[model samples]
Target: MPGSSILVTTDKESVARRMESLHVFRLKLLSEEMCWLILSQKAFTGRSQASREILEDIGRKIANKRQGLPLAAKTSGVLLQDKQGREEWQNVLNNVIWK
Candidate 1:
């Protein structure tokens, strides 16, 4: 097995420790801007410029509540994908999970 390599990714420290001599690199959390970018890309693909401007502030708030987690932002984006109203986005920002 000369010049052969295998790459494995895991979030659990226990799993990572089971293998010796493995190179480990930790991933950094997303920034607020990055989270907003992901959410906007997922939820507002065809939204109008005016609509985007109207919702941008609330969207940033929602993105901030994601706590720099990409998965959280992606999930929120999916939840808002079909919603276009400011109230709908505001409702998400007001959700108890962010409390």
Candidate 2:
């Protein structure tokens, strides 16, 4: 069976909820470049150590991206918005490490 078959089920609402959780990564509004950087790191390394480094890099980049924003203000939102964003996100997913 295909790998994607595991993600399929008869319950559409449950599937939609799962998809939403999987799709949305907490990201700052101006961190497009940082997101791409994380995506690239994730694409290259398959080892557990490399995975930790990639997550660390992502967290660090998000911290840096939040530097200019207000002290009291916190921005949290989905990583992808429209069709183009979804396409780009899927391209990243296609190259990711699945350990």
Candidate 3:
């Protein structure tokens, strides 16, 4: 006979309390903070290797967006690319910095 798997409750509060003894609380907090830092860097291409990369990237993108005569829109695409890079850089920063 095959063993039956148990169905655990999917409640957020319950899950959080259970994670206290399992040591996942700290990990979750770190993950959240890292995610915030990464997602906030939707500029500058997020290429920096530090937690503040998002802030720096945002600043860079703003600067880049301002580099033009008559307000050319050539740098718009760079903003999109930088947004993606910011997400990736977040993961890298979290894994390398927090790990």
Best by lDDT: 1
Total clashes for model 2: 0
Query: Candidate order by lDDT, highest to lowest?
Result: 1, 3, 2
Identify the runs in model 3 with alpha carbons over 4 angstroms from their true place.
1-62, 73-82, 87-99
Query: How well is each residue in 1-99 modelled by candidate 1, as lDDT tens digits?
Result: 999987767667677678763677778889999999999888877888898889889999999999888988998988888888999999999999765
Ranking by TM-score: 1, 2, 3
Candidate 2 regions with alpha-carbon error over 4 angstroms:
1-27, 46-99
Q: Rate the local accuracy (lDDT) of all candidates.
A: 0.86, 0.38, 0.38
Best by TM-score: 1
Q: What lDDT is obtained when candidate 1 is compared to the true structure? A: 0.86
Better model by lDDT: candidate 1 vs candidate 3: 1
TM-score of each prediction: 0.73, 0.20, 0.18
Backbone clashes in model 3, listed as residue pairs: 41-54, 43-57, 44-57, 44-61
Per-residue lDDT tens digits of candidate 2, residues 6-76? Answer: 33333245655766545533334445554444434433344355544444443344334443332211221
**Higher-ranked by TM-score: 1 or 2:** 1
Ten contiguous residues minimizing lDDT sum, candidate 3: 68-77
